[model samples]
Target: MILKLISRSKQLVPHSPVRILSLYAVLALLLFSAVLLVGLMPADAHAARILEPKQISGAFPTLAASFNPHEQVGHDQMENMDHGHDSGLSVSTALFYTARIVYYTALLMAAGMMLWFSGIRSGSDEQRKRMQQWSLPMMRALLLASLLYVFANARSLMEGYGGGGPEWLRLFTETNTGQAWLALLILSLLGFAVIKASDTFKLIWALLLLAIESWSGHVAALQSNMNLGIVLDFIHLACAAVWSGGLMILLGLWFVDRKEAGRFAERFTTAAWISMALLIITGAAITLLLLPSLSYLFYTSWGIWLIVKIALVALVIVTGALLRARVRRGELPDGLMLKVDAGLMLVITLIVGVFTYMSPLPDNTPVRFHKMGETRHFTVNITPNEPGTNQFEVKIWLPEQLGEPSEVKLVLHSRDRQQLAPLEVPLAIFEDKSYESFPGFVRTSYHAEQMDIPFPGKWTAELQVVDKSGEKVEESIDFENY
Candidate 1:
């Protein structure tokens, strides 16, 4: 069976160097595809314990500073509780990295395909023969390297999926490994030999690694349906590789084959336009799905970075158009045109790099509460329901005369509020009133001026409340102390 396959491969139609170049072209595409797959499949879980309170607050100080407009001050301060925005930000960041790889890889691959097809269509038989001769070795080397790179990165890709490990490590350890390094080395050497020998069958064999690596990411059964994300990620990645790989080829041809520059540029222009359209359409779709809310887009650092990246993309498009027009008018020399195009390509690469760290917006909006105002007093009324577990009734009395409490919290005493800890109070809320359970103590939910204090020693409770300005306010219990 293998012998038959080898015979068939060697007999591929037109058996020219152009056909052989397809092998390298495909390999380049697969490499970027793998990158996209790894990148878009969701980043490995990194949310372990947040750093110190200061660090948590500092990581996004800009967003933090703007919290007043978007959040409740004094209540639900940024110092506590992991915000859902973090998750959204993470999603966006991961996709940004993936998108970057996709864009560049797609550009290179698309350029290559464009140049190859165009050259073949217009060049003479001798020119075609020269291309074939040169392409054989070059394609072989690229194919070999691509195979190794893919396999080498496989383990890191697999690690993204939950595997057996220490509980903490499972959530935080990010692996960038591919597969067994030694195995990759051996395969790379062997593939190199096969390509050098023009063993066409081995090319297909090399492609198998890419297929396997991509498939491994789709084996999940969780609420996130990570499997679906993995699949979409792969599709997105494959498209990117084709686009980038082709671009690389086109660029190389435009520079090296100056005599045939016109044909090469024309071919690349068409491919670039098509690739750009696909890039914009797919990117928009992904953005819409990932960034559902405009608020998330504006309130997070990820959103801001994304805006920056999109602006760069706009510049790239404009520059690309200018270069194409110059080439058509024959106003600019091939050398200068190539340099300008290359510069534009670099700008595109830079945009992708910036995208690597931003996060995506969330699909749903989280519930938010208002902060206590000057008229309001931070209050917590706990009523005993059982011997051990108490129904916790927590509320910030909005002074009917003034407005709302200065702050609201859940704690034994107001003094305990600054302790920056969650109060393990058995608590429940009933409408406007709160209920709590205290051992050997009892109290009603609504008692004239907030009843339901059992234990002495100035017990306090801490609660997060938002101010009118939407800034989080950290109000504590005053109790016997301040």
Candidate 2:
């Protein structure tokens, strides 16, 4: 079956079998990972533990049927569903996954552009003009898109709430009324039309949009640390797009028009150098912010994936440098360079596919909790730490006159406010009670015991504190780690 699939891939792709196989390999990995994550999910507290697969299948048949026994779909589901909630995987994972997929797609588009550019021109002035005539509209469309982005971003900046959400709209806009939104839409169309007329204006408009994006990010940062995450996310996106998108354009011109290969190669080489530098710098900065320690890099799934991405990027640079040297020495034939460039770009895309499967470091952090009990009810707070490592502290408070110690039970399970459950994770803690000489009550705190969780996802920690007489209090906290 695999061989047949490979054979079909070779027939479908215009490039080499190796290239087609590489793409399929990446797709397989992504599908496998996603299935693994979903299939292995743990059940909520209300669920009964049945040895029968039928019990499991009856509830999640759509998910179960997607995997074979060896896929460990059930195992991962049990592990994730039974374990505690993850704080890291929520937002950071979302950002990393989204960014990597988009960047990879952009890289593939670059490869396509290269092939198109190289295959199109036959050194005739008439043919070159004709190609340009056809391509001009595409350029105009891209410019128009950029302009639209600019206007939309500008409105977001001016209104403070931006198109991203209602919160951003409320933050920037003096009035969150329908008329303002309508006006912004009209302005965006006007901006797009204006920018598409010329390259110079398009460039200007793109820059303006960039400025607006930056400003909006800055404003977002002030509201919460999540804003900083938002800023970094945008920067990562812009950098990825510039490098990948620009490369796609350059490759297109070189491969499609053999006559213009030399000039296009030279121009692309220069741009590639700049893009490589930016990619490296921003990538490093992102790493520092998320993977602050070697513990994170070596221990966490997100860290491991990031390491893989860095290695791939290095491979890309080396390949690009080699190609640049070949072009300089006139050793690479025009047609061959096109194929080689496309192949290498494909490698980048594949690496990005893996990256998308991994969680982002900034978003995946361990959670800590502090508990306060009132006469009427008990309250619990779950505080998330910096991304990468899983370590959280728990604190408990009891009234002095209760005379009996409360049996505090903490359960780390996988579930959310959406559909939650309790898991049988028997966490044991040994602590001694000492009087602090406070006026009335004693405060009991538990030092954080580090849980070495490798992957990024959602987890919930439930606390069940009972007195010696069996009077009990219950609370739960949710966390996500990427």
Candidate 3:
């Protein structure tokens, strides 16, 4: 269907500068609004605790901490979580995304140069000379970007770990991300040494580099049918590189000679369309695998970002179709349109970098566990046992002689006794109607409430209930916070 639409839109019509400007203006407005909406929306406070540092050390504490370096390490680990965007502003994360953009841009440029070299036979002498002129510098940039990516990634990992030494080394040597980085370093060295290699070899190596990148992302963490996920991810990364990289090369050549660039642009448009089709298909499949339901697409932060990416990609496709139409008409392609398309692609790449670090699952639902009360005959089901905010659901079942409880209260006690007072959880009745009786005892009521655990450790929950007869029953359940 996409191909048919592209084919139908291929006929050249008069290029109107006003229309082009208007199109871009609309796109800019849409993008700005989407960003503003995301910014204005409220972020989950509990979700932020999972990623951001909760506090900053005071000057006096820092000075005193210098005497005990190990204590500082522990403090840093406790402070630095998974570094989610909702948590806070993270300089390390910003740098990491910057590094990713540079690295991927360099990779695409290298791949574009290879694509250009493969078809060097079809172009004029001047065009061939232009390709040779840009080739070495692009390869050198790729090597530099690859090295910078490694350094930035290592620094980010160190920040997450609180410090780096043997731990960093272990991560690099033992983890899948580390293995992928090691492979990329080797490829970078090879690329540097063979700057003037055959086009096929360079292209093959570039694809390999991108494939390793796929292994470093969320796809690699899949436990069910892992091979299928990795294969789809590799194809997605490869197609993206080819489409974007080819454009980078075309943009450069278009400046040298628009007439000469038209021929290559025509060929690239066909390839780009094919790449775009595959991207949409693979992207949809991956999204379905990761997302729990359609509701998450709007309700979760991850889904909002995915929507932004889809919008940017739609802009790219529209721009590509217009460029192809201009090329087919034997007219100079719209330079402004091409630039807009390339800029959007770069922004999309940065979004991809952000997504790589984020969790796809919604924060509202987490790991759940149930606790049974021995004397009170009630069960408390805790949704998400993590050391942060949680929801507790209580279900009470009474014996044939005992009536349903009239009141229930939840209390939290710190095992270490460091807290000044036990925290109380105010639970409201969720379902109070009596259950149908077929057995000796009948199920009664259920209550639920939200609570926060400030720290990770052992804690005890005390449930106190007042029966219909005014008899009070107390039961305690112990659990550990992650």
Candidate 4:
């Protein structure tokens, strides 16, 4: 068991300062080597056409909006598929993210306490008794969090469906998220039976929970290099859970029993160091596998959040160094740094929740934009904004006030410093029943199965409509020609 690893790690020969430096030097070398490999290694060039956008404009802000903007294809849809801006967070989206953060905290804290207090022989009687007193409540919290996660995920999947219980059940039981939630619920329920079980069983139980989380993660289902992705993510989540979760419990110990906490801090912090090392390595690898290109690091919402997470993680690392120094100096030097570490960790957890919620690939995610007006709305969607075969969808909406349009058409023109004639594309009236999300607007849709984008460059799409009175309205959008 990994708990046995914790005990064994403690008995290893102590490293002198020179030896510690050497170890760090070796780790740094490996880290750079890994980063280099990721950089040189080709991304999945033949990615899905209907890509997940590397969550380009999809993150916490975008999660509030639906992924399938084509359902109603109106104002809400336009807002969601907007290229760069964030849509307001919806209530359901908020609930999903909140449930996720709660479950993350609960899982980390509960599992860390169980493993440290029961699995490790070094843990004192007081620690074991304390863990016991907290076990029931912690298990209940995990169960509750798991249930919340299940409901929130189901609600997200069922958005705009307006289906009854049967549909909801189908979505849960038939989808990947549903299966993951099922496993999580079962594991959470199993935790109750093992609350007072043997320490080895507790370790196995904790690992099973981590495995569920990893299996449910986006990495696990990666179509390219799937096995490697799943294994890396499982190990990644395990290490992160051990370090962050144990740190949370350690913080609690500091408050309730500082003397015991002081005795435990050095060993726990030392273990955290190793866990953190693996965490960084795998996290970097996962990032490389998921991100479409290096440019995405600056251009996308997911990338931005990742930068924020990494920055905060650096602060946590600094706090860890401070803690290690304090432990070695025979004084905590006040718990100010500890509080700082906990606060940073909590924020990082929330951001991590965003990462878990969004898609990692550039497949279905699109470069979508729209022009809205008092009378009409024009929208365009280009899939996987890359030079190659792509899918294009154009939607035009006219309010009832405008009456029946005599003529409505869309035109395309290349914008690369060259004189080119405009090409007109036919549009057809589209009707959809799901009007609850975006109502009052009648929409017409045009779809192209495969548009061979000749090159990666700028192009302009123009929309022109003629009202009953023969008055013409025009609008154009310039895009990277996705």
Model 3 misplacement above 4 A: 1-86, 119-125, 160-164, 364-482
Report the lDDT tens digits of candidate 2 across residue range 1-482: 01112135443113345754575467446434533432343422111111123434464432322311212212233333322233666773354444444434532232222223322223334433533444444444434443443344334233322235643444334422222333433433444353334333433443344333333321222212223333544444445545554455555556566445555555456446655665565455444433323455775665676677677677667767876887788654345545565565556655555554444434423354444445423333333432223344445555667633466666666543324344433334447365433344544544444533323346666777776567777777777653
Per-residue CA lDDT of model 1 for 308-425, tens digit only, reads 7577667657766876787678643356545655565555555554443234522222112333454444445333321112334444554243334343334454232345343444
Best-to-worst ranking by lDDT: 4, 3, 2, 1
TM-score of each: 0.44, 0.41, 0.62, 0.66
As for lDDT, the candidate ahead, 2 or 4, is 4
Expressed as tens digits, the lDDT of each residue in 311-338 for candidate 3 is: 9899889998999898778777788987
* Highest TM-score model number: 4
Model 2 residue 193 distance off true place after TM-score fit, in angstroms: 3.1
Worst 10 residues of 2 by lDDT: 43-52
The C-alpha lDDT values of all candidates are 0.41, 0.44, 0.64, 0.66
Best by lDDT: 4
- The CA root-mean-square deviation of candidate 4, after full C-alpha superposition on the true structure, stands at 9.7
In model 3, where is the ten-residue run with the lowest total lDDT? 56-65
